[model samples]
Target chain A: MSQKEDLSLFVREALLAGRPRPEIAEVLVVAGWSQGEVDEALSAWAETPFAVPVPRPRTVVSARDFFVYALTFVALGIAAFHVVWLGFLVVEMLWPDSDGANYWQAREARNSIAAILVAAPLYAWLTVRERRRLAADPGLYRSAIRKWTTYVTLLIAALVFVIDLIVALASFLNGELTGVFVAKVVIVAVVSGVLFAFYLRDTDRG
Target chain B: MNRVLFALMGLIGVVAVGTGLFVFGGPGTARAEREDQDRLMAVNDLARAISCAYDTAVLPEAIGVTSFSDACRPTNLRVSASQLMAGGLLTYRRLSDHRFQICVIVHDLGRSLNSAPYSDMTAGPEGAACLTRDMQG
Candidate 1:
């Protein structure tokens, strides 16, 4: 409420978010306060701690926390699906069709499967590590973890899908591909687009 | 008891969502699939048509070199002619007497997903599709 309180809040936020001290001056400037005013305000707040009693430890997770839970499960889902899909790809490649239509098709499918087989699990691990890191923080303990992991995973997944979609669409748009390739592109777009949409929507709303 | 009830409710919600996905195929699935079938079949027909369009009446089926053309690689044109609507725009290339290239390609969304399963397409001439889509890296 007071200038001192505002300065303390600013310091707390900046420190918590790991911003450099030099940037605090910029932050103060942006907030339309002079450096002297901000420093004085912060000093006062630091000198006088809040007099309220300690609050109860959190038991029930906030919606953001629950979002982490949901997203973790969703990651598992994606990992599982891709794992199976990768297996199918391996099978197709090992026993590729003898009499040939698309020679490179089988090979491509095989490599694609292998790519997901490696990336999905690695991404999932990074996410879990971040989740654990957040479990200790008082305020952003759980949230920071979930958000970081979700953001990273979402970005990687989106990039992967978008690139793949472009590749798939190339054939049909160019008219060099057959109707079936077009159909495959359509299926991929529909399926992955739905997942991408859900990820984005939840990220925004949460 | 409350926790148990919450768990039960959550379970019900999960089941409902799962059922909806299964029964309805979610949002644009059916529509996408309807359009996709033409694209998917194009792969099949492209291979078949290419084999047929050979200057020689030789169907590659007699030999062992024909599978569905569902991979997206070196793709340039994807026109949907009335003829392709019924059959397909399959073509063949004879590099030499014994060593020739018999292939077909159909463009579709699934084929577009060149990350894991489709990325393999970029390994060959079909990789042209990959080049077009992912020129950055």
Candidate 2:
């Protein structure tokens, strides 16, 4: 049918016929396929001594996987953001600024706490459930959606670090070294650092 | 490790919520705050109506059941009857023909409402706060 399908078929036939992978790769490369394409075609099947070539497991595209991972990450984001917000509120309350104990600030703390109460439990439940599933079917590690979501989270965490540094340096230059400001900066750094570390390790495992 | 992290996060959430309640009080405090805000808005509306009426006529001794007067009645004023009956008597007193003061009893919910006309109001300890204004006619 398609050129790539034809290539995969040829590679499978060549492997079953006992043609070595490197020779097949070289033959395809000489026949004008890129080295990557030739390598990919060869690597699609396992290199085992058997009558027929065995196909390596490919990344699954499942709607259920997408839904679970989407909900898990959304909950994680909500919980993380509000935790940082609550930390900032706590800092502000402890170190009184000139304009102290605002009604709005108290209201905001209440709202943040409410969000954390809901989101944190949801995230924990989803993660535990997913972990159980992953244990049963370790092939779920090959989920393309899971990998993409993890990378997106890592990217956001990296951006938060860059922005935090920029703001910290800017505040230092501007002489805004108040206890509240410093504490808030530290809160952001600690939370984001934890997230980045956890997800980075998670991606490695996946 | 994952389980530990999840438990820790959940614990943090609970702790933060507890701290929030400790510092800011609970749902009752929130409800009181909302009631106080509504009281402020109602008082503010009454004041604005009095100021408007003072442009043409003398300030009314008391706000009417619905309207201050046909010309200066506040449109869509949301002051509740219970709020009005409870303490929002909005004691109106005239300093002069063009100057007046309106006082309303408000609960001091530790709200930092220090801005504009509210800033001018002299808030007493857990009682009536009054705002005196001159008509800019």
Candidate 3:
């Protein structure tokens, strides 16, 4: 059993033995468990007075869910890379002196364009598929993995947003706020903002 | 679900068309760019070879050239197609005693022509060329 399972079992046994909840919590805390863990463990058995509660079955992810989620993750990664690459291309096109286009840049721009072409469509398809599935069965929206993935995407978007802000601020402070820098900052902001807004709205709707 | 599938199908169609265009249209531009890069490298190499001959106190004829002044011409030098010296695509001429010009037909103009000793030239479609001073002096 995992440490959490062991802790839950210990908490259940202590509660059944009529030990005071405070004492159980204190002992667990002294045994290196955090107060938060002790409180959570205690709360799991809080209302069970006489009858032993049946353990809830663990949620099993279906193949379809796995496939969609995996595909979405891969698409999101590709989208992020391509978005940054496209930003660089735009910057180079605008400011050729500071950010000149060379053979490698041309090659990268072509590859990134191809990647975005593929990944953006795939991402849209998976997102629409998941949204439709959730609409048909609202309960599916509560799936742990789905929620986790959405939250993780939100986290990444937030991080990118903050990083873009810092980059823009640094560029401004350095007096390097050329058209290229401004364009790059705008691209990053727009992309991350759209991702943040979409996920935030989805999470809220859920 | 049907709507979702239809949208996905539509997206797939768009991607297919985009990929087809890229596959077909990308290579021609790529090949031209590669050729331009090769031409730039060849010009620099020729300049270096001339400088080497002058430094070693050897005649340009020793390196399969008639003379240093006229050696800039494509027919006078031996270089491979990979160096953009094939089919007389590149031309060279000694403008004066201390200056020489290398000319090439480049399709793309957005790239920097910052190759040393010839960085001042602007890329153009008509014919992008750079003049450099003979470094041998």
Candidate 4:
């Protein structure tokens, strides 16, 4: 059998033998399996007062869940991007530079506003619908696609957060940290930071 | 908590869009800006034709469209009816032998007047925001 299969069998047998989880984990660690591997192997079974070890519900693949989650997150991504864009544009308008490019800046603001108008509502709707579904069936949170998409979103948000700070620091070093520039930087941070924090909490909950 | 965030986002989107629309005007503002650009382009074209054919064209008398078209024929530029009707009438006047002025109607004078090329032009009443040029210069 594969090493993973062996690990699973070992964990199940140990649990059935009425060994404490920490003792089993310590034994696995002594055998050179990582703590994460041991924990995953142990967590495969639910803790219950049953005669035998009971398996937890595994992550199921659902096409409908994939579609709903994908759409919801895509809409959210678009909305977040445009919201930051619009916020930057607004800051620029309020504290215009000496070049006086208000006309073009206003035009871009309109486009960002239009994108936000479409995507934000769609995001809100899909999110509300998904929340309702999740409320009705909390087990739906265990879908593999949901976990994957959530991680992907977290990855993007984290990247944005890092990139935003990098750009702000670069601008500061260049001595271009004007009021408008700093405001734009803060806007990006707030938007991406919110997404990162929200999804980080969500993944923890699951 | 998710619902609360969603509601907050929805509210923000609506408010931002409304403020943007109020500040930048609507889709019509973009259209008007384009129309103003086309009108300015036509004015430039008309001025070039006038400068090119100044020797053969009539002096002063506010250079009528027919006369402007006929003078520009030999220079291989035709002042089309559509160009004239794009924004409003294009008017040309010979200020002196070496200088001339062209004016066209603009929908959003405040925006167009602040922009490049147009910013250099002189603001006049509704139908006649004028850009003056010297052929010799």
Candidate 3 per-residue lDDT, tens place, A112-169, comes to 7778778877887887878788889777866767767778989998999999999899
Q: Please, what are the lDDT tens digits per residue for candidate 2 over residues A1-206?
A: 99999999999988888888889988999999999898888888987677899999888889998999999899989988998898887777767553344567778888998888899889889888887888898899899998998899899988997899899999999998777888888878877777787678777666
lDDT per residue (tens digit) for residues B1-137 in model 4? 36555455567677777767766678888777777776776676667666766754445755544555564742333445345744357766667767888877877666666667667777777755688877653
Give the best candidate by DockQ. Answer: 2
Task: Rate residue A13 of model 1 by lDDT.
Answer: 70
Model 4 residue A67 CA deviation in Å = 1.4
Model 1 ranges with Cα > 4 A deviation: A1-142, A204-206, B1-137
- Tell me the whole-model lDDT of each prediction, alpha carbons only: 0.43, 0.75, 0.65, 0.76
> In candidate 1, what are the lDDT values of residues B1-137, reduced to their tens digit?
13343233234334433433443243355444334344333434344444444435333423322332435221332434223433523223444432233223334333333323233322224422221111111
Docking class of 1: incorrect
lDDT of 2 by residue, B6-110 (tens): 566677677778887887677888776666556666667767877776776665555553565677666665665335645544566677777877666665523
Model 3 misplacement above 4 A: A1-71, A95-100, A173-175, B1-25, B54-86, B97-99, B109-125, B131-133
Candidate 4 backbone collisions, by pair? none
- Going through the candidates in order, the fraction of native interface contacts each one reproduces equals 0.00, 0.35, 0.12, 0.28
| TM per candidate | 0.30, 0.86, 0.66, 0.75
Give the worst 10-residue stretch by lDDT in candidate 2 chain A: A94-103
